[model samples]
Target: MTKGGDEQLVGSSSADTAASSTSDVGLVDETKSKGNTTNSTTDPEVDQPEVKKGEVPRGPGPFFYIGGANGAGLVSVYCRSKGWQRIHDNKREDYKLKWCETKSRETYYNFKEGEQLLYQIPNNKVLTTKIGLLSSLREYERVMNKISTNLNPKHVEIPDPKVAAVMNPLVWVKASEKFSQRILKMEDFFPESFRLDIKDEKEAFFELYKDTQIWICKPTCSNQGRGIFLLKNQAAVKSLQARLQSIEEDPVYKKLPYKAPQARVVQRYIQKPLLLEGKKFDVRSYFLIACTVPYVLFFGHGYVRLTCTRYDATSDDLTAHLTNQYMQKKNPLYSQLKEETVWRMERFNSYVNDKFRQAKGLPKDWVFTVFTKRMQQIMMQCFLAVKSKLECKRGYFDLIGCDFLVDENFKVWLLEMNANPALHTNCAVLQDVIPTVVNETLDLVLEIFNKSLKGQRIVPLQTLCHFVLLHNGGA
Candidate 1:
């Protein structure tokens, strides 16, 4: 679809967005009483002995535990700032908050909701995994299509005006017309993707392949641009199929603890991408699911990552096509050109304003306005797609790194969502962004947790920092 089509859809759908926003606030209020039911509810007060107002309520010193090396230092520092002690033991279940890069079932089993906080939902793979996301989007699209079809026009005579108002399809359609118009179509943002592991999806991909088009094959769960390649013709597709078949047929491989990387996906590649200074790049944004029970979600800004080499549609080098920090680091001159590989969103906006604003007839500060809202809407749709299936609790929270690619036409496309996104402060831009992200994340977590525990409001958050609230699901 054209960019104009997307705008029209967004404009029409947005007609009901204001009403939806009002309803969301109403939902929080309506669920507040239900939210304070302790064990059975989302934001129940923990059972604690009453203490005098002047006397400091004391327990276990409000201890916190850090589980992995991803962002341990920053987390520890943040905990210290809150006057919370850090426990080195991973097995302990007494910690008030636990932030781990890797999910642990034991920790979750012992988690004390309403009294503690945990990072990451246990079943986040539904949105994190490549194949998992694709499946969810496809299923959501099918369901939405069915609903739309059922709402189609049908003629029926009614004896009474009130009965007609209640039973007539036109009445129902008029009521939901704006809402139906405001939603995003799955194909509008997500690229055409097929799971190679599924026989039917694989065959469909093969049938859809053409010599003129480029398809990118990727491992479903792998990150850092690993195990990715381009399929330019029939030969590459057949070769990949043979390799997968061989891996599956290898009984010897099955006996081992680790299996071969047979679970893969082939996505239609964006041939003409919006390049910055002639180098391919992608925006790395964030989706924060801060609270699961009465879900609270936010969108945060992130820096852009560019390839080390210039754009080349027919380039044999993968570095030119993949705009990831890990891919860029592999180049021999990376050490000298590292500064050029990353750009802060402000810098990026300035560059675009200077170069393409008038030429493309874009609005002033288009990055902060149009592009930012577009990314948030896409993320909201993705969350709504898998919201019900996600495992939720009072304490569980998650932050997902969402990557997006803009075509030459300025249309945004969601590439993938990554759980436990890279927090390395290796580059100058990262050094400035990652720390703020971590600090603000903790600030919001603590603020909301305290309010929720005290049966207060989760909206009107004071420590939102750079985060924008996307969904306020009652707590």
Candidate 2:
């Protein structure tokens, strides 16, 4: 039917994207420092440094370090390619900045009080958080209320210390409160969820969700598919009784020091999920915040993940319900479902756009429009959930990952927000995308860090990731 329609709408090189998407909150084009950005549309290969035809990238001024082997290999390769050195002991090199998953006193080596990383306040230099705020969002319900009280989008307010905690499944009550306050009311997006603590509470929520078609029980603070299960009805909730009996049998776990909230959130399950080839899918989004409140950069391209097997509500198997990549990869169909397993958002657009437009009710760009708006709202709410407790002095930067589930009606729902998501480029699609974003994110960080050092306003550089100002409270 067509002679020469562009077959590769989404396959352009990262360079093309970097050049075309040079937007910033304020000031000059954030893409390049002078006439350095290349706009020519060459055969798309994510070019190898400046060797591939683009202008030479600026030299990395400060050396960096990576702790906790999460993304060390990839960062090592990047460090070598850019002629940047990675230091082992901070004392061994003039370590300007470093990345680590956990915030320990040991992680702050060689840096004085003012040095930056991700840490709690009272620091002279900006520091990043070690826990759930790789992207630096944690919900201090009390503090959140205060931030909203004196809310000035044009000015930053020093938040007071109010019993602080970052978002996890445990804060459904607070999330519910905020969702109900919104004009459109998205309270239904998040299913009815409640915490089960002390023996008496379990039976209450069990009765609460007793009539729901399905329910899911999740641990308050855990990762990598641990202690998660799906329950279809009252009979299924009864099965948890056996597990609770076991926990009661052993008090050792309760004795562990600095324990996370020993709570479980039971949420009503979405019986009708939007599926691809009958498999449940969820979109993943990422953000990095290295600056003060209201100012953060959003990555433009995030990907989608699909379940290995078709979603079967009746199936007893865990893989059919939980779409966690760490768990889904173990399913035997994971290999056979390679293309169906993960997708670049651009690939998703090319595939879904025309098909979605074939119908008359929804707009052609609904994904970019409605879908994106929903995402931004969720991200902003999440940030507000913990804004007051987050320390955003100089030198503090973080990367965060969020997951969302869309129902059959294309209604997006926030599944969970995570800090310090595993940075290893393990998936096939990740080999190309992960390293590129990591590199670009680092550059943006450097740009800000250098600017902050010289008392200059920080402007975001062109992004492989989209940078959106969720809110802008001037400092």
Candidate 3:
């Protein structure tokens, strides 16, 4: 398949259009009713009744609404396969499922909790934005540390000797492990980060800064490697600090939100990243919050995004440093070398096996085993970090795109999480991957939603395809 143009993220301003592949299906326009139905009390096609009290009656139905064109093709195909009719109007609240690219306040305000399947959980920025993630992680760390201190052996109860004889003596150890399992050590997977907007955090970064160190500065709310640059010298860091300080002091800038720069975070750059065939790359994986009621989560494999040119630490071009598809597309050789820019997980696993298996003392299938588990653990840690803070409802679900970096030492580091990941079938690998991810996402969502509506248990999900179960908060 020839690589077409890339698609926009969830909150992007791109115009929404019906999937060209689904041209045969009728996607009823919201602005104009199908002829003669404008004055009718109910639409005969969907059989939806007139609104009462701003809510539709609760029940499973065969109507879906896709708010954008990014992944609309696969979503439409999936809905069509299930004989579900598509709802074209974004304002229509009667749809059984609404997959909106951008999260809107109106959607949540009008949400019929248990009756509708909404795509994103409200207030998910707690884990998605750079500053939000950093804050949540720090706050979570503080809470967990306090709890762990209380759970120390010194505070443990002294068991009866006679009763302890038959029971496992490692009760406290098990308890501690159980608590720790929910959140991994941030240092183990996440790079050190500091928020530039906060004064103390900014000073702390400068205090810890070294002449030889490198830091990658990024915008808090942006994606696709936009406004990301490396700080290799003290001058670069100071310039950034001065610029931000000026902005903070500018009353006019503060009042004009549209002109103000977004908040930012500077992360210690992974200087020794492992390269594939001399090109820098990063793994793009899925962290799906499939169900929020009791929280059913999954981890799905995503293809690797590799830089077009050979990686060079001294290179000033961002295309050499940033491995995102958007960054790579800027290179002149992108169209010719496009095929080498993306690799399926299996290809990555095989390459690692052949190249670094013996040399690095890695396992035969290290990519699928150790590396995968590391990613899962990191993702779980991030989820648990903001689990309590996230706004949850029965109908809400989320699919976050998680970026990971593998160092030369085989250490996995979580870079950042994106709310609305791109689902463009731009290349051969995306064509093979994106559709499956969306389909399985819908499959599991429908299964859980339908089962929950019928008072059925949420476990033993029969529709879980390639997605691996991370956490099942039960029915």
Ranking by TM-score: 1, 3, 2
Off by over 4 Å in 1: 1-59, 155-162, 165-170, 252-262
For residues 1-475, what per-residue lDDT tens digits would candidate 3 score against the true structure? 1111112111222111122223213433211111111111221122233323335434455778766555755676777677677756567788888876655557767889888898866567677778777777887889998887666666656568776566553776778778877666789888999988778999999888887998999877766676799999899888987898799889998798457776778999998899999989999999998888778899999999999989888788999999877777789998899878999999999999999999999988999999999889889888888787777788788888889999999889998887767776667787789888988998898788778778788889898879999988883
- Model 3's alpha-carbon lDDT is 0.76
RMSD of each: 12.5, 15.0, 9.6
TM-score of 1: 0.84
Candidate 2: tens digits of C-alpha lDDT, residues 1-475: 1112122111110010111112111212111111112212321223233222123323554455554444545555665566765554433335556654433344433444234543222221111111222122223334445554444333333354343333233355555456446523235445555545545656777556654577777754455556678877667777787667666566675676233334466666787887766788888776566554325545445678888888888887888888766667679987677556787777666655765556536676766677778887776665654554444456566666667788877788877665555454446676666666667666666565666666665444443244555543433
Q: Model 2 off-target regions past 4 Å?
A: 1-62, 90-94, 108-188, 198-201, 245-262, 293-295, 358-360, 460-465, 472-475
lDDT of 1 by residue, 1-475 (tens): 0001111010000000011111122221100111111111221111123332234335667877765455556777787777777665566677889876655557767888888999877667777778778877887778876776556554334678887667857565774576577678878999888888778998888888888999999876667776799998888888987897788789887786155553788999999999999999999999998887778889999999999888999997998998876677778877788888999999989988998899999999989999999999999888878887777778888878999998988999999998777766677787789888988888887787787778888978999879988888773
Q: Is candidate 2 or candidate 3 better by TM-score?
A: 3
Global Cα lDDT for candidate 2: 0.53
Q: How many backbone clashes does every candidate have? A: 1, 22, 0
Each model's lDDT comes to 0.74, 0.53, 0.76
In model 1, how large is the Cα lDDT of residue 267?
Answer: 93
